[model samples]
Target: MRPIHPNAPGHGHSYSRSHIPVHDEAKAHLIASANHSRIVSIAAQKFRRRENVIARIRLVLRILSLLLCSGILIVLGQAVMVYYKHKDYVVKHNGTPDLRLWPRGLNMKPTLVMLGASVAATVASAVLGVASFSKAVRHITRVGNVVTVLFSTFCIAIWVAAAVYFKIDDFDKTKHYDFLSYTCARRHDQVLDNAVGNLGNLCAQMRASWWGALAESVVEIVSLATVVWAWWVGKRGGKYQKIGVEMLGSG
Candidate 1:
């Protein structure tokens, strides 16, 4: 008969190792901590068991993160187009949207500022999601779960600010209603109704920007909730207590 070691995987029936018990006071505490953190990891892992609620939440968060990225792209792209379209238009002696005057420059544009924040948050979310998915990189996922709340909060604020401004200042009840459709509407039409080419086209671009910003904001909020909950389900004491006990029982 071959000698059987306690740690061997298939020796459960032959050289049973269930008799051992952890007697070291200090070692027990350390093993418990490691096992607790392991549960947290599985809760956030991409290929985790489907039955676990935390794993399911993490999966939803992954999808939302991807949508958030797309939304960021749409918002930024529309903003850029609208800014350029009205580059030459003026409102009450005020020049139109331009990047040169944005923050880091003496003059700053609120919409542009929001756009920048949204872009950064989107990138952070993407990296965070990727770290969670890869599993191969454990440390990155841990760090990401820790800080994602901050970035997601930033995204939510900026998005809501832009969306609110769009609804209140751009559209109205009737007649003067400028945004005819997403593809066409007058930007500051109350002021720039005179812009030379296809004012409706400008309107469409602006509408797209608003929708994109709003959509991402909602998605980020949900993602934040899910991530926090996931951490909660993973970190609770009991999840790892069994593992720690098992480890102790193994030898």
Candidate 2:
């Protein structure tokens, strides 16, 4: 008020000294706020990118799991078809069912039953497994695993029964049949006796060898292993989800 300078406030000044620092501080705060906003925007963008990548990975895994289940189902179906066809052939021909068709050394009927059951169970498991791959039904994996395990156990039991039967069926002295005319009058009786003897021996040998039973056991074991593998995969997927969450959080 004594002598107002040209640059002093309330005179012909641009700004007061006290206001200068305040303006500088305000500018600095604005710049800092802008910088913070930029950083936050960049971080958000990065987080979104990471989330997209994780989602893709999870989708791929789910597809792979579905494919695996489909493959298993196909295999089971084929096996069942072959078994039924062979069974039909034997029934039509009125011949003793070829024990060879039943896994290498198992009892015939038990093997057939086990294989049939396995096929049915495998189909059911595949359906459930596929359903589990869906985001909405992932919880079905546990049920699928249980069914698979049960099917495998049944297969093992079938093999065991076949083995027991094989132990009782004798192969040696088993008779062969020829539907042709015979020369000797006693040929018919001899042939018949031989056939009965051969069948008895074959049965005894089948009971003794235990090949069919072993086949069922092996198949069951594989089924059980598959179930275990599926369970592990599901667990791994759960871990991946946690990792994905952490990745997003960090981003």
Candidate 3:
């Protein structure tokens, strides 16, 4: 006389309302977890791009810095060679590439002092580049950048002084009728037998020094600045943390 049970013999059994809801809730939780996990994964993937971009930029800057350092050496060497080749002719006339404008302080090779400074700066920059590639130590990069900045600044100052000292003489130019030929006359060595070679050598040195000071120096400064910027960005103190529902829940 009691109401027939659903599971009674020959009776078809259907899911109970309470049990059905339980299974539905379990399935819903699984789906939600999967969706949330995917979203988190996607977000993480996107955030990684920012780091990648910074790394790529840093690499490019390192390459450029290396090239600039090389330019400093190559250009300065060209200038030095020009002076060396023609200086013998000038030396006989008691002419020195002396820093006559400045009082003798170190008793060093006057014209070579600037070139030496450039070598030091370029070497320091090259060392920094190597260190950056080998190890990304934050303090090291900061210190390196400071050194590079100071050296590069000094380079600019010396470049200006050297430019004026090595300028072409106007009176001589009028006489020689050519810039290179005039610089040769300024050498004050009339005893040189090879007139053509003397003019060419003196003129070459003058132009090489001028171009090194003007073009290569500019690139070196820019390279130093870029290195500093890259280091600063690479050692960023702040990170952009993305707020997420999962993080909040976990908190």
Candidate 4:
């Protein structure tokens, strides 16, 4: 081996100039790799955060959906029961006493029609609301949620109005029957009085429908407000999701 100088250009103690370029390249590669890893980690974390938010929103929506369905079903069920009970009363008392003096009790067909409309609207609203939560169609979802909220509000309003009207009508009928019973009783007609009294008793029993109607109205109004709130929240969530998508795309 040759004896090398201490300041040799490419030998012994002197660093190779070529190695500096390689070292710089290695350092650049390492920095780029670290940047890529950091970006990936940040993206993953953001995705997870968005997913958690969406999951929480979905959970809240499901709970609201259940409550809405339950409330509507309960009101509808009670309306149906009242309809059947009234029908039975009318049929059973067809030939008894002087019920003809008073106006006939409520006709159930109109109530049925109202209930049918309300149920149909509510079902549509629920279906749309559920569909609106899909990320693939978030814009459509926003529109659908808006429409659903409107429909739900309309249905609730209709039901509340109908129930209030029905309650008022029931009160009127009750008053009429009471007067008839009192008049017949004062006339010293025992058989007629007994029949009228029994009929009045039936009317009194039906008074509970008024209370039920009021309760249903309150529930429906609250449900309407909740649906509106959900719609607003969903809209906000959709906006956030859109922002997230844009950020991801840009990144």
Best model per lDDT: 1
- Per-residue CA lDDT of candidate 1, range 128-157, in tens? 667655543222245555555666687677
The per-residue C-alpha lDDT of model 3 at residue 69 equals 45
For each candidate in the order shown, give its overall lDDT on alpha carbons.
0.54, 0.44, 0.51, 0.49
How should the candidates be ordered by TM-score, best one leading? 1, 3, 4, 2
- Global CA lDDT computed for model 1: 0.54
Q: Model 2: how far is 118 from its true place, Å?
A: 11
Tell me, by TM-score, which candidate is best: 1
For residue 147, what is the lDDT in candidate 1? 58
**Which one wins by TM-score: 1 or 3?**
1
lDDT of 4: 0.49
Score every model by TM-score.
0.48, 0.35, 0.46, 0.40
Determine which window of 10 residues in candidate 3 has minimal summed lDDT. Answer: 99-108
Candidate 4's TM-score = 0.40
Question: Can you write out model 3's per-residue Cα lDDT over 98-126, one digit (the tens) per residue?
Answer: 32211223122434554664566567656
Which digits, one per residue and each the tens of the lDDT, describe model 4 over residues 64-171? 544554454555556456435443332125567534322355355434544564466457546655765665322324554455456546656665675555444335
lDDT of candidate 2 over 1-251, digit per residue (tens): 58757766566745654557777867776666666555556555654454344334434433443343344334434433443444333111245543222223223443344345444544644564565455443322555556555655754664466345423323322321111111111233433334233333333332222343354456456656655555555555555555545544443
Stretches of candidate 3 off by over 4 Å are 1-47, 81-110, 135-240, 245-247
lDDT of 2 at 90: 19
Candidate closer to the true structure by TM-score (higher is better), 1 or 2: 1
lDDT of candidate 4 at residue 114, scale 0 to 100: 44
